[model samples]
Target: MRRITVPIALLALLGSAVPAAAAQAAPPPSIAWTACDPAEEVPEGVLCATLEVPVDWSRPGGPTIELALAKRPATDPSRRIGSLLINPGGPGGSGVDFAYFSGSAFSPAVTDRFDIVGFDPRGQARSHVVNCDSDLIGAQYTQLYPDNRAEYADLRATNRALALSCRELSGPLVTYVDTASVARDMDAIRAGLGEKRISYYGVSYGTMIGQQYAELFPSRIRALALDSNMDHAQNIAGYQKWESLAMEGSFRQFTSWCDRTEACALHERGALAYFDELYARAEAGELNPDGQPLPPEDLVNIVFGYMYNPNSWFELADTLLYLGQGDGGQTGRGEPVPNGYLPVMCSDFHFDVGAYPVLRAIEQAQNRLAPHTRLNPLAWSDLASCQNWPWKVTNPPHRLRASAELPPILLANSRWDVATPYEWGTSLASQLPSARFLTYDGVGHGTYWRSDCARAAIDTYLVELRTPAKGTHCPAVFPSSPVSAQAVPTVVDPLPQLTGPFRR
Candidate 1:
């Protein structure tokens, strides 16, 4: 879990600032592309550019902020259909880095037909960034379980202080980094590319951006494919509960695999019991002091992080074995890799945690129902810190409806996605008047990177404008045996393909 800030009185200024410049006829925004700097990671023919967008859409001409953009042009420009704008869904994930890293992964057909483009959302890396106290963040880390009322109170206070620190450091842009704003930014990118209608590929929180863009400018979308969908319809408590349940399910799957597979080092010792012992030891703070000892929360985080993709299961198993043997010093399991989770998430949903007692009740209930996911407390409590957040939430949770004239948007989700639950994909599909849902009967979060079925569907939909039939299901594919030529190995598979190349 990552830490975030919740500024106080943030909403009071909404619409209170100088009213947005009145609607007026104006020239479309244009991007001036330039050759990217020499770098090993950047592919040939990829161009980078920076465009300015208003901090407030209402005032499109005022207080401009620079947006970083990058593009990998179609291999066959003559055959190009249009620009394919992508958002990798950190709300903080860098679209620019994603395009450079994963450009080659797309099938040749896609590369030939589309100019792949990516941009860093406002207040994200490579764009205008949100700064805070790195030391404070490093020290506090994420608090997975609040053992008592005082601990919960301390957590809240720490959150409040952090929010203030971030606001002071991040400035006004932090208050404006909502999905609605990013959706508008997408439209600008579409215009800058000189495309009448842009195709889209959004995953995770990126799905929310796609949904909002559909609602706001449905006519501008040529084709949309949202993977690992996010249902922005739920409020704070509901959102927390949904995530908790999903993580609990993934936890069970992980332990079950460990129990049945001889490949798992702890199998003979009873994987479930081993896990229980690890948790108990963590809680007791009895692990060795070889380096930086991991608390119970971080041990859970390490396990939970690897649960996103089973390809990493072997590595996860190895990591657990080392920790269990008291061999830990500094572990990557709990290291903080910030992707601007705070500004966007806090601006989108308000977590309504009242007094300390209220938080206590919520934590107790979640623990009772999902003990394995005591991790939810930290993930959820971070939201409540927004109560006094200085910036107002510009876009609260709401049902999104795509225009009837829009093409049927494609949705892909795995059956056991802990980060963005499969249920969310299904729920989002139902809400959209025009949608085609493809279910991957596999583990992990995003599907296109790992499942052949998913890739085929996405390719057909994006390139041919053909939607898969409703209720389409893709079967799970396990790692192949050593002697079996039929198996596709993804042991080091990254959870979401686009961000994989950049992962530390």
Candidate 2:
């Protein structure tokens, strides 16, 4: 997961509209591939290219932007099917990085048959990035949990300032980074590759992109594998209740693991109770050994970040134990503000927080629903960050209208996913005309990475156009031995580190 610093500033800057370039008839794009940049350290066989597309699809002959693309060619070209476009779900996540670094995460069955192509969606990563003043972005973090109307108003002003800064610095592209635009960009990529149809593998936020693509161009997709699905039909209330419930469920899973596993640092001491004590200390302004104050939100974020993967539960236990003993360590510091998170989210979903009373009521409801974790930090952050966003909701929440002719889409989700809830996968499945939902009875955000059964199902669907039977469920898989301090698994997925809530 990419971690970016968001610093808040009070400067005001006026944004200018993008100037239209020379008018030309819209034509199918083509790529001129070259060797991967040495600095990127992409695997030996990967090639890189860029596709130039219009900033606004409505004005096909308008200002243009270049999207970064990376491809790992199929190892066995004799059996190669086609390009399998992959996305690792940070609205801000780098597809180029995922393709470069985590291509090995795919099963050999997939790797041997399809070229793994990853692209940084418009305004993400190597694409024309959306940037704002760091100080302006950082200021909003302090108001994530406002106490009164005055604080809430301050939060709104800060959010407005951040949006204005992004507009001024990033230009018109800031207004067009919604998932719908990215979905259109995906088709442009397909056209550039000269492919009649493209298969897709999207996780977390990427699932939203995949869904929008399938909706807009159903006939253009050969297959789609969406893991840890996003429900585009949710309103603000649905986001709050379901996201918080999912986090709470994951927290319960962790506590249950501690109860049965002797290797858990807090097994002897009650894990939930110890976490409560830490939260109390944080709220009371207790300083860690390093003398930095651990705010309650920071403490919650630390735990939420670790909850993405079961293997990281051991690290989380150790970190909490250290914090309890007055050792601040690395995890004590709060996550940096999420840059480029608000624009896409605010543009895509309408968050009608309304007046402070309404916001306060929402907070109270979240607290009641999730007393243990307080709330999903990512969910609350998304709500708070979009308070005074300058952009309009270009793609607001609604039930998906997928084409009946669309190929069968494969959806997977863990039973206890902390980010995208399992209900979202099922909900999305119901929305699509032809979709099969695969349940991973496990405890992680991305089911494909955690369950071999999920990976096999997805691979078969992508390579052979075979869907798993309806209501397919993969049994949970846990480490044979309890996780010890020295045995904590390395987290390869970057979604957890990204600040946005839906990042898988």
Candidate 3:
């Protein structure tokens, strides 16, 4: 692995200007719809298209990248209101895949009234993806949690190497994958589709894009629905605190469920104590149900992934029970490879832990905030991975500047979302005075698919332009047992399919 060093002068150039393509007076060229490639696996009626957007929005005539798009035409074209753009929320999530596979997730009323459109944001799937060396990414020294100064240096070195590889393989687009750029691409999409305004459904990280778009093009939004929101106003400490707090809260909810639910495999053994024992075994390098040892970080990541949905609690309980009983049959699950989306995260938020001392302090605070979970795997990963990322912070965290003329945007989040957290939604609602917040008293990353009440509220808001009543709350729904939980089809829940650093 070769260590690549970038000059401080180049870093300054990268961060010099925030792209403002949405403010450009010139209109984008219209898209020409065509059939999707057979490999895309789109449904029968779905149409595919590509729109040309500047790799560096500030230099519109310099270089352009193609943004992939998918659209499911309205079921009833006669009553079509407009296009409803949907994004499934990884900083790397494939909106095109969401449009093809999860179109059924929306209500018939919504489907009948609007064309469901999804675009793979720049440097994401179908679009020009950020590429990096896999071996460097998977290197043992690339661990996110560094204990000492030497290990911290190795982590930073590895991150810089990965960034260099991405730049080398991906070209200039890698330096411009910020959410603000994506938001500008969205406005371009709206223009290309020839619609005066477009309705939007953005979840998790996608909410950040939607929020920025609203700030840039407030008058051009027909309706906006932000689910599992990202609070773009947090500093380093605030970001870690809220994320770790949410992860810890979800773990507690799982333990509480195990205590009362007779169907939970770990109910008799005690969920928390059993999990703690597993953690101890992992740390001791003895927790090997299959032949390979499970590292403590991997153990925590497994738990973190399961916490994304309440329906997966039973599966999580069973997995832990199997591990406790030394059942190799349930082990040996392979982790997803890195998709090189860190630049998007690195650019959108500032997570610079200047030195190991600052990093140690942040870890201490997180541990105190989330003793059982220790730290949020995703949140900590973002903070640690961006320590020495070569890309400049193009769209750093700041107060949201939503327009007063903006319509009432609908916001929804689960009370126990391990990924996005409930307070993020409320925090955003406070920032956008016209926005209405909807709370689902549940455990999950997203509210729309998990709760019918939430879905109804969102659909009504999107289709009828009527916001949910102030202080509206949706009841949580839980499956009876592990077997019954498996009955919930995977297609209905589209977010978990997204694979990357920020799986939200």
lDDT values of the candidates? 0.71, 0.80, 0.83
Rank the models by TM-score, top first.
3, 2, 1
Question: For residues 1-504, could you state the per-residue lDDT of candidate 2 as single tens digits?
Answer: 122211111000001133233112233446778998887667888999987776876665568888999998999999899989989887898888777764557777888888888899888878988888777655777778899999999999988988887877778888999998899888878877878889999999999999999888888899999999989899898888988999888898888888788888899998988888888888889847466888888888888887777877877888888888875422222332336667899998988577999999998999899998878988888898899787789988899998887988899999988789888878888898699889999888888768778888988998899999988899986653443323523324555443245454
Give the lowest summed-lDDT range of ten residues in model 1. Answer: 6-15
Q: Which ten-residue region of model 2 has the weakest summed lDDT?
A: 6-15
Model 1: runs farther than 4 Å from truth?
Answer: 1-27, 142-144, 289-293, 327-339, 381-387, 480-504
**Which ranges of candidate 3 are over 4 A from the true structure?**
1-28, 140-142, 327-338, 488-491, 500-502
RMSD of each: 6.6, 7.7, 6.4
Q: Give per-residue CA lDDT, model 1, range 278-365, as digits (tens).
A: 8888878876537666787677666767766766676666777788886543423232234356667778877746566776777666
- In model 1, what lDDT does residue 369 have? 65
Model with the higher lDDT, candidate 2 or 3: 3
Q: How many Å off is the CA of 207 in candidate 1?
A: 1.0
Model 3: C-alpha RMSD to truth? 6.4
The true-versus-predicted C-alpha distance at residue 26 of model 2, in Å, is: 9.8
Q: Would you give me the overall lDDT of model 3?
A: 0.83
Which residue pairs of candidate 3 clash? none
